[model samples]
Target: MVKTARPRGRPPKDADPAPMEDVLQAALHSFATHGFNGVSVRTLNRELGVSHNLLHQRYGSKEGIWRTAVDWGFGQLTEKLSAADDESAPPLDRLRTFIRTFIHVSAEHPELLRLMNIEGGEPSDRLDYISERFIEPQMARFQQIWDELAKRGETKDVPQEVMYFMITSGGGAMFASRALTERLFTSRPLEPEHYAAYADQFTDLIMGALKD
Candidate 1:
């Protein structure tokens, strides 16, 4: 053997690298709290404890990082929605499942709603990109499901866009208004149990209202 040349320049570090998901999650939180124009690569690197060069190397630019972060956040929601839509159940059950799932996802990832709200507050390329890449597709899918339910006589004949807005905005309110939610419910914490109970009640309320 040639002694392996001492494995090149130096020994491997014992520290494990951060996963892409973790990076994206951190970016999501940062970008959601501070809009794209408000955040800097250096700030993100400092918060993440990584080099600024890493963000540039991986995403090429701040815009690229914003795009990736938005994609990652919405990708998670899309996966959950797709799974709920695919479940082999009655139309009404599927509708309820979708509503509950949406609320649960919003509660679990409040950053998603925050980021969306921030983007929606101002007109920019970032907002347009997110709308085109994530929001439109998600809305289309939900519209298809809603239309199916209506055709099956399971749900009321409501416009797709109206129902979509009702479900997303209404279900996301608890998560999107953290300060208000905490202040209003000062006696108790907004724990997972609270979210679960809310999801159940919200699903019932929406489904009841959507009945023919």
Candidate 2:
């Protein structure tokens, strides 16, 4: 069998991470504003005031810069989420806390969340990386909560997969729905007020479905 070419090394030893960060921030903004496929290297170069050669020399390719931006965004997000998980509350309470905090943060960081949603639709080589790095660990946390509920005979016939879907997807949809919700109602934000409503609705709906 023919050998595939391996990926290159990290940035040069003397290279500053700052310029790379600028490129990443610019790329992420473009991706979130337009989309992953909609962005071009020229567009990124214009945004960052960097030459095409600098971008390539530092990042290898546009795909490399995009991946770096996506990874950095997710890394920041995971830091906040893991911090939320570390709060000294019980499991279910902790889940709700995390959800509330997540929605609050999403409202504050729409571009970041938009980047994530956009990446979900793109042809990404980092799907497993994203999941394993962020989603799976959180899923395991939820699984522990679900296990406790099940032992108490408080759960339904629904599988843990469905429970995971309901919980996580509900939060995902809540954050994603803000744009549409903003169109219908004006003069009010979704984070504190409307987000609470959605969270309560989601919790009630999920609890009703899961509870025997």
Candidate 3:
């Protein structure tokens, strides 16, 4: 009988940008479909169409991939927010722009939000990295905008955290309740009109909350 040799150690770290992105995309899909608990290296490798070595080489583990996926999602959000020409508009306009963009991006990339919710509960290194890098920067930018609006008397004197949650909750609800909405309402995917109605209501809610 032939004897098998001892197993080697872990593969080299993934350093290529393209393959890294591919793996990230697969992880995002897994998280969206099954939530955090549902993803695994075997499934990820299968979905990515890469070898187990390749997956491990790139992300180390499922947790690492989840972290990177969350970061990528937040990065996409930052890009969407930045691309809007209405950044200089009034606070309410800014809020509207963000809501519309948020819905558009979320509809396009539901996996990202699902991954975000999955990684949110774990106190892992990737979570800390995302919190420090992506979330903090975004919050600071929002706070500056809020301060500007406050000065202009467009916004009430509310704590920054409260404002952040209020804005985030709109997006969160749409994402979190998406399945429920789809099940109870029409089966057709969200259209511009659907998002528009939601955005309008969200904007009105924010305005009402801030009005003196």
Where is model 3 more than 4 Å wrong at Cα? 1-22, 32-38, 60-64, 85-88, 188-193
Best by lDDT: 1
lDDT of 2 by residue, 48-125 (tens): 665556777777887787778877776776677777775466555765666555555555555665666665665566
The alpha-carbon deviation from the true structure for residue 46 of candidate 1, after best TM-score superposition, in angstroms, is 0.8
Between candidates 1 and 2, name the one with more favorable TM-score. 1
Give the residue spans of candidate 2 off by over 4 A. Answer: 1-22, 112-116, 119-124, 154-169, 172-179, 190-212
Question: How many residue pairs clash in model 2?
Answer: 0
Which candidate would rank higher by TM-score, 1 or 3? 1
Report how far residue 14 has shifted in candidate 1, in Å.
12
lDDT (Cα, 0-100) at 192 in candidate 3: 48
Q: Provide the overall lDDT of each model, using Cα atoms, as 2-decimal numbers.
A: 0.81, 0.65, 0.67
Per-residue alpha-carbon lDDT of model 3 for 1-212, expressed as tens digits? 99998658854343333466676777777776787677788877766555667766766777777777877767887787778736667776775566566656665566655555666777866568767977787677666677777788876798877766566655555555677767777545354456656656666677677775
The window of 10 residues in a row where model 2 has the poorest summed lDDT is 10-19
